[model samples]
Target chain A: MMVVISYDVSTETADGKKRLRKVAKACESHAQRVQNSVFEADLDYSSFMKLKGELLKIMNKDTDSMRFYYLGNHWQRKVEHFGIKKGYNPEGTIIV
Target chain B: MMVVISYDVSTETADGKKRLRKVAKACESHAQRVQNSVFEADLDYSSFMKLKGELLKIMNKDTDSMRFYYLGNHWQRKVEHFGIKKGYNPEGTIIV
Candidate 1:
């Protein structure tokens, strides 16, 4: 699976640098620097959940924000009926 | 190469219908209807070029516009130095 994650955070937190460090370190395996503060990479489903969970936990209590852009194959919009499969043909995928 | 194409035209063109028709038809083989005017598909590089060329030619003389989002593997940012190989491992790619 290949993933692309681009994120930016408000620079208002006293621990802004610390938070960013935690984020980078936590997602080290699934990401590499893209832009100065943005990172991108690939990971499986379990890694995805773990990364997201870690991000949520690592953020400053209530003063920080984040956004993720999952790019490449193996990426899909979450759906209740059809979650995810190990692999699927990616011809003509309509993404919302 | 998987492609995700979402296009919205400027509504003021009188030939909007014709232009859209051309675009839809040009990309018909590489795409399938996703939203009312949006489409998604997979196509090799040669096919993608043909579709783009057709769209450019069929568009109103000076009344419309278009954009393309090439998605998934085989889809890549144009780079002069690293050109493109038929296939490449897509993990940890640092796309610009």
Candidate 2:
């Protein structure tokens, strides 16, 4: 399954800033950053659950917001993109 | 159908800034702003098509990136959110 995770963490204070970095780093470990606060992850059912649990722990329940879009296996057919940044295939080869 | 539209418009130039406001306004006309550049809209097929056309015209293909997610009628079941900002029901009451 492919999951799209988007989050907004409050950066009004030093604590909020630290949480923001922690959340971003956690997502980066499991997925590729498509935008500043968005990530695309290719994971199995168990992995997705684990990732979600980890993120929930890092985010504040009162000030941060997180959304998970379960794109299923046919996510490619479900997404449409336009403009400068092209859509990336999570399964495709990366030269770098 | 319900649509989630997200965009990132380059603001490196004065013209880009203008386009950014245009894009945001276009989206604001049809949906609720859920984030700086994200919107949630409840529209029929024709309305969705018209909104897409209008946004494409406002955006600069060379510098802006837009994504449209078709959540279908069952979007309520397909989305999960966590934290401060509660999800607004697009079809529910809005009392000003």
Candidate 3:
């Protein structure tokens, strides 16, 4: 499955700032950062659950916001992108 | 259908900034701003196509990027939200 995860963490205080970094780091470990607070991850059910758990632990329930869009296997057809930001195939090769 | 629209419009130039505002305004007419550049919209197929057309007109093909996630009618079950941001029922009432 390809999961699209987007988050908004409050950065009004030092604690919030730390949490923001933690959330970003957790997502970075499992996905590609398409935007500053948005990530795209291709994972199996179990891996997705584990990633979600890690994020839940780091996010502030009262101030931060996180959303997960389960794009499933047919995400390629469901997502439409336009303009300059290059789109990547979740199942394609990366030469990095 | 409920669509999740997100965009990254370059603000490195005056024209880019103008386009940003235009894009935001167009989205604001049809959806709710969930973040700086993210919006959630509830629309039928025709409305979605119309909005997409208007947005394409305002967006820059070379430096701006727009993505649309078609969540279909069962979006509520597919979307999961956590933390402070309140989720709105697309089919619910708005008392104003």
Model 2 C-alpha lDDT per residue in residues B20-52, reported as the tens digit of each score: 667667766688766555677889999889989
Candidate 3: where are CA atoms >4 Å away?
A: A10-21, A86-96, B10-18, B86-96
Who wins the DockQ comparison? 2
Taken over the whole model, the C-alpha lDDT of each candidate is 0.48, 0.71, 0.74
Candidate 3: DockQ? 0.63
DockQ values for all predictions? 0.03, 0.65, 0.63
TM-score of each: 0.37, 0.76, 0.76
Summing lDDT over every window of 10 consecutive residues in candidate 3 chain B, give the lowest-scoring window. B87-96
Which pairs of residues have clashing backbones in candidate 1?
Answer: A92-B41
Q: Write the per-residue lDDT of candidate 1 for residues B1-96, one digit (tens) a residue.
A: 655444444334646655666666766666764333444556778887676666667765343334344454644441011111221112211123
Worst 10 residues of 2 chain A by lDDT: A87-96
- Pairwise DockQ winner, candidates 2 and 3: 2
Candidate 2 global TM-score: 0.76
Off by over 4 Å in 1: A1-96, B11-13, B74-96
Candidate 1 chain B least-lDDT 10 residues: B79-88
State the fnat of model 2. 0.80
Higher lDDT: candidate 1 or 2?
Answer: 2
